[model samples]
Target: MACGRFKELMMASLDGEISAEDRAQLESHLAECADCRRELDELSELSELVGEIELPRPSQEDMMKYWPSVYAKIERGAGWGLLVIGVVVWVAYGVFLFITDPTTGSMTKFLIALPVVGALMLLVSVIRERVNTSKTERYKEVER
Candidate 1:
């Protein structure tokens, strides 16, 4: 058997989960390959050490609170999204009025457009800064 195949069988053997035929092949490979034998021994020792570890369990109350906390976060995010959409629509309407009003002079229209354009530019800059900051944040890696 190839070294890779033997290594896979070695893991199965350590877990006592290999078929008789695979076990026989693995044993044969182990007898001839010193490197495979050493690796198998190291893996067996690591598995034994891991088996002795005891992980902490979460409390019942914490488990119960998890879903509601998640839901609240989702609700807040949705509320903010709706607020932004409403503000954008209101600004767009103001721009439309400034452009189409017959009595509004060109200078007056330009003055109104300046604030709208400046507000949009500021909004874009803030959003881009937030996106770049999030990209650098390492908290996402912990969730995985």
Candidate 2:
């Protein structure tokens, strides 16, 4: 009954997915509503125009060259860089907080900080190595 529901039916009609009942309902609405009729016409024209468009498919060489160099390196570098920085800042802050807390014993703080610091250092080292490797391997393809 609502125009919005009728509009939905219009899309279904365009896609040839409307049932006979829905088609009759939509036609009844379209006959009485000038605005709905206009909208349906516009949607039909748009569908036709879009259907006529065809994008050329790139060759294998072009597809291979598209990524790995420009987008892949940039995306990986940025993501890794953010991860590293965030880990460092947050871990350092957590350590600083634990160290300064008066209620916690110095020994307890040391015990907790030791493993956290070790893990953080190992993580940062691995990430740095990975970033370096990625930089070097940017232009090369994986050998199968």
Residue 90 of model 1, lDDT score: 99
Per-model C-alpha RMSD: 4.4, 13.3
lDDT on C-alpha atoms for all candidate structures: 0.91, 0.90
Count of clashing pairs, candidate 1: 0
Q: Which residue runs does candidate 2 get wrong by more than 4 Å?
A: 62-144
lDDT of 2 by residue, 30-102 (tens): 9999999998899999999999999998899988898766898999999999999999999789877877889
Which 10 consecutive positions of candidate 1 have the poorest summed lDDT?
1-10
Clash count of each predicted structure: 0, 0
> What tens digits encode model 1's per-residue C-alpha lDDT throughout 74-104?
9999999999999999988987876899998
Segments of candidate 1 deviating more than 4 angstroms: 119-123, 126-144
